[model samples]
Every structure is written in C-alpha cells, then in structure tokens.
Target: MVLAELGFDAGQILAGLKPWVECESPTYDAAAVDRMMDLATYDLVAAGATIERIPGRMGFGGSVRATFPHKSAGEPGILISGHLDTVHPVGTLDVLPWRIDGNKCFGPGVMDMKAGNYLAIEAVRKLALAGHETPLPVTVLFTPDEEVGTPSTRELIEMEARKNKYVLVPEPASADGGAVTGRYAIARFHLKAKGKPSHASWALEDGRSAIAAMARKILQIEALTTPDCTFSVGVVKGGQWVNCVSSLCEAEVLSMAKRQADLDDGVERMLALSEEAGGVVFEVTQSVTRPVWEPSSETLAMYDLARDVAKEIGFDLTHGSAGGGSDGNFTGAMGIPTLDSIGVRGHGLHTLDEHIYIDSLVERAQLMAGMLMRLA
Candidate 1:
C-alpha cells in the first residue's frame, strides 16, 4: 500500500535529491552548506513543519530542527537525524552529474546521505498526503558538520535525541543491505614534534630531525593496532625543504574500539610513545571523543520492526555494526533506541562513484512510511 502511494512519486523523489546534491554542501564550505540547509528548510516548511533554525558559529553551516504537529500529546516524538555535509568538494557534480541509467543513479553525496535525508521528507510527505497522521510526533534534524565527525552538531543531536522515543539515522544501506545496529567508539588525537632546523648538506650533525621522531612514533603506534581496535594516522605535515632538516611535525590520529576500556587503554599507550624522543618536543593530546554505541535490547527490538517492514517491502534485512560513526552515536550513547542505514540501496560511499539503486527509492520510502504507521 505504501509503495503504491510512492510508486508514482519516484521521479519526484529523485528530483528532490538532485537539488541537495547540486548544492555541494562540503563541510569546509560554510556558504555552500548553508544553501543546502535553506533548501531543506523550504521543503520542510512547505510540508507543514514548524522550523527552528540554529545558526552555526564554529565556522559551520549551522543546523535545522523541524517539528511536525502530532495528533496526540501524551508521548515523546521521533527524531530523524542526518547531516548535509559531503566528503566531495564543490566541483564534484560538474564531473559526476546526477543521471539514471539502468539500475544506477550516479552523483556525489547521493549515497553517503543526501538521498537518505531527502527520502525521510518523502516518507513523511507521503504519509501526510495519504491522510495518515501519526499519533506519535515526528521531528527531523539536519546538521552541517557530520562528515567531519560531527564537531559542531553533537550537542544538538544529543539534546534532541534525549527527548525523543527513537532516532532514525538515514545513512546508506550496508554493503550487504543490512542496517547499522552499532558503531565503534571513536576518538581523535593530535601529535606534534619540534626540533632545531639545519641544512642537511652543510650542518647534518647539528640537526635533530622531527621527521625521524615522527616516523618512529608512527611505526610504534601502528604496531599496537588489532583487528577489533586500531589506530591510524590520517594527516601528517612537517618538512620545509628537501635540503633542510625540518623543525616541526604534526599528525592526526584516529582510534576506534568496541569498549570504553579498550579506547582508554589505547590512548594511554599512544601517549607513552611521546617519551621515546628525548631531544625533540614530542607531544600527544586528544581533540575529540565520541563514546561507543553498542546494541541494546531496545535497539535490537527496533531492528526487529525494521526487518518485518523490509520483508513487507520484498527484501531480506540484516543488521550489524559499522567502524565509522554517525549522529546515531550520540543518541545511542544516551541509551535511546536508535536505528541507522535505512536509506536507498547503494555503495561506493564518499567516492566519485557514489550512487543509489534507482529502484530502491520507492521501496525504502514505503518501508519508512510503514514503520512510522506501525510504531505510531
């Protein structure tokens, strides 16, 4: 029934996702991101959502929270949370414009989240248009900085999640078409080293290379990695010239663990590596920390509902954990029942080939609407 409602609206759904993809809301580009927010706000307002705009001050595009009126007022509502940022840069669409050929629709940001974000609107819009108002309230959250680990939107996501009965994150479907049931704990560290600079050819003996110390630290830190928990160096910068021994070096380290104790232990071990360098300035400090989101009976129960919904829509559904993090992490950490990856079926996320299965558009929308009806 839900699919038949949305079957005629497939083109409309793709049309909705195109504007957001073309807006090119990279997290670093504040103005571009704001455009995406504006577009979403306009659509939500037209859908009868009461809009609350939160200005982003930490050099971000800010956030938008829209609340749709519920039929009854006895229970907490639902929060559908996602972000507008993409890993692709501004000119990505110039090369990989949105197009549908066979089963695929290719474009940047379409798979990672823009498609998912727009699909939520389509879900609620379908319900409203069908004259099916939910007794349980509904809310949607669009943030600007989720692609870069949600630095600006964590608190807002948590605040909204704590007040809601459930959080549904519209990320992409898993590689095997499963929903994300849990996510690893994530933490970031910045390492820096400083030493005297000298000409490599003329004063080689007088120079103490920060690069050398950094290399040692990188190797030692990487050796501590395991299958479940691991440390990775994402960014590194240090030398001035090929002929000179550089005086400064810095690196961004990312660590993930299944448990809090393991994450804490990993940080302590990495910090101990700073003592390896006596002559140079070796320092390790943590920058951001997102606690682990493990599955609970509550989340598992939500997945059971999702699984039944997917089956009704003619698909087999599975659930698992992801190494990466999402806004769901904030809500799940607060012990709110959370479910993720209910977007269109697609893969190659965060890449130029990012796309969604064209046929899954209606199916996912119907599934979302069905879940809303059943839960409400």
Candidate 2:
C-alpha cells in the first residue's frame, strides 16, 4: 500500500506529541481540556480537514470533529474516535515533566492517549502530504470527557459513529501488546448517607453516625465482588468534627462486569442498599455508564484486517476484550464494526510514571495508515 511506504518521521512525531503531553488536560477541568482541543483543531485543519467544534455540555470541555477530504466525502466511511482528556490534573506537569530516557518517553497522558491521537493524525497528514487520498473518507472525533466515563459526550459519539461504516479508537494498546476488540460493561454510582448528629461523648446514644453507616455499607458493597462482577468504593468523604457524630457522608462506587446481565444484577443489588439501615438513610444513584460490547463477527473481521496490516508492518497483532471502558464501548455496542486500542504501546496508565515506547510511534502510525488505506 502507498501508506505503508510513507515512512513517518519519529523525531517529528515526538515533536508533535510533546506539547500535547505538556498541556495536562484533566477531565474535570473544562478550560484545560479546551486548550488541548484547540491544539488538535489547529493540527487537523492544517492537515486539510474540515473542522467542527461542538461546545462542551455538562461542565466538560468541547469536542473536535475533523473530516478529511475524499471523493466519497459524506458517505459511510471511517470514524476515528479518541479522547483528549487525561486523568492527570492541570498542574501535573510540575511533577511528571516530559522527558525521554533511552527508548521510553515519559510524561503525563503520553501513553494513555496523547501519543495515540497524534499518531493517527500524523498518519492522515502523511497520506495527504504524499498526495494520496484514503480509499474511504475519514472523520476524527476527539472528546474531552472520556476518563469520567464519557458522560458529557456519549450522545455525540454515538451520533457521529452511526454515520460511519467503521469506528477506530486509539486508546492505549492493551497490556499484552494487542488491540481491543471488545470491552466489558462498566457502571459508576454515587452513595450518600444522612444521619442525625450529636456530641460523641455526652450523647452517644442519641447520635446516628453517617460515617458508621457508610463503613458498614462499604463492607457490604465490597463483599458483593465475585469473579463475574467486581465492585469498589474508590472515593469517600465524611465527618465534620472529631468529637461529634457525623451527619452526612458520600462515596463513589465503580463496578465492572464481563456481561450485561451480571452488571444488571450488581446494579440491582446496589440499589437495594438505598433503604434506611440502622436509623441512617442511604441513597444510591447511578452515574455515568457504559454498556457491554461483546465482539461480533463484523468486529472480528475488522480485527482480521488489522492483524493482516500488522503482519505487513513486521509484527504479529492480537486482539481481545478489555475490562476498562472506553468510547469504543459505545461504538462497538452499536454494532459498528469497531476496532479499538490501536495506539502507542506503553505502561503505567493513570499514574505518574506513564510513558510510551518511542519506537512504537512510527510502527503504530504505519499500522493505522495501512488500515485507513485498506478499509473500504
């Protein structure tokens, strides 16, 4: 294929990826994420793409839509999906500054997605520069709130994907150096406890401690974890004074299940805990959710295409279902023939030590370019 011979420049690719890692776009900070989106807009427009900026809703940053020029312009083609937001906060750069040590390049969000998004953009740009149009039209959609389960932009993602023939997500490559063909069901919940407050020492019998109720409930939630379904109370906040019974407490729960039915049962049991227990009222509310996306035959065919492309690029590619949820969860669930996690290979995701293998930049770009050229 013409794209396989494009020969992406690794130095130039790193140059393009550095500023993005330095930008530090956390999911909760709309302005920081917008800055990242602005950078993407500039790059995509420069690559001869038509740009559309969708304003952020629900207190999240806006998303970018870039459509590459092609003869089959508006027909069903490829939808390349990604997220610009990272779990790292804005000031993370001060701690985990961008650096290159040997074959590894270290920075916040470098591997989790910045490098992946940049690689896809670079592949498209190289094809454009070489005066070769893709076999099918291409549209790249970068959202700003994926780390928080794509709460703000799920509707937009599904709408754009429906108009396309296939969906490709450049989330970080799987741990086993493979791509994602399917994703597990994921659900997040918020729990609250309300109790009467009183002096700890003087009126112990009169007090109803919200923290005590939440502690017991936390144990209950954790005990529900099975091989098929697992639960975790990751965040908790409660208490006012050391000598007084706590009046209120709140916790965030995350659940992951291999199947939709397992997740549904888990959700049902979680909701059952909303009743009053031990004189304290508990509330369970479902937050952001991602439905299960099992691999279909069409998705398997897409993976076969990717594997063939990888073989031509001098590497064997593998595919499997992953636990962590991504925008692919939304697209694949729609039966859109989605191929996901076709991005840079790296480790330490969602941590300070996050980084990518510098060599994978060009290799993955070539793989992506091949897929773009070969996909009809």
List candidate 1 stretches off by more than 4 Å: 1-3, 6-8, 73-75, 276-278
Clashes of 2: 0
lDDT per residue (tens digit) for residues 257-352 in model 1: 988889888888877866535579899988778888999999999999999988888998899988788888778888999998888899788877
Compared with the true structure, all predictions reach lDDT values of: 0.85, 0.93
Candidate 2 lDDT trough over 10 residues, lowest sum:
1-10
Off by over 4 Å in 2: 2-4, 201-205
The candidate maximizing lDDT is 2
Highest-scoring model, TM-score: 2
Q: What's the distance in Å from true for residue 67, model 1?
A: 1.1
Q: Tens-digit lDDT track for model 2 on 1-376?
A: 5445797988999998888989889999999999999999999998888999999999999999999989999999999999999999878889899999999999999988999999999999998888878889999999999999998899999999999999999988988779999999999999999999999999988999999999999999999999999999999999979899999999999999999999999999998889886789999999988999999999999999999889888898899999999999999999999999999999998999999998888889998898998899
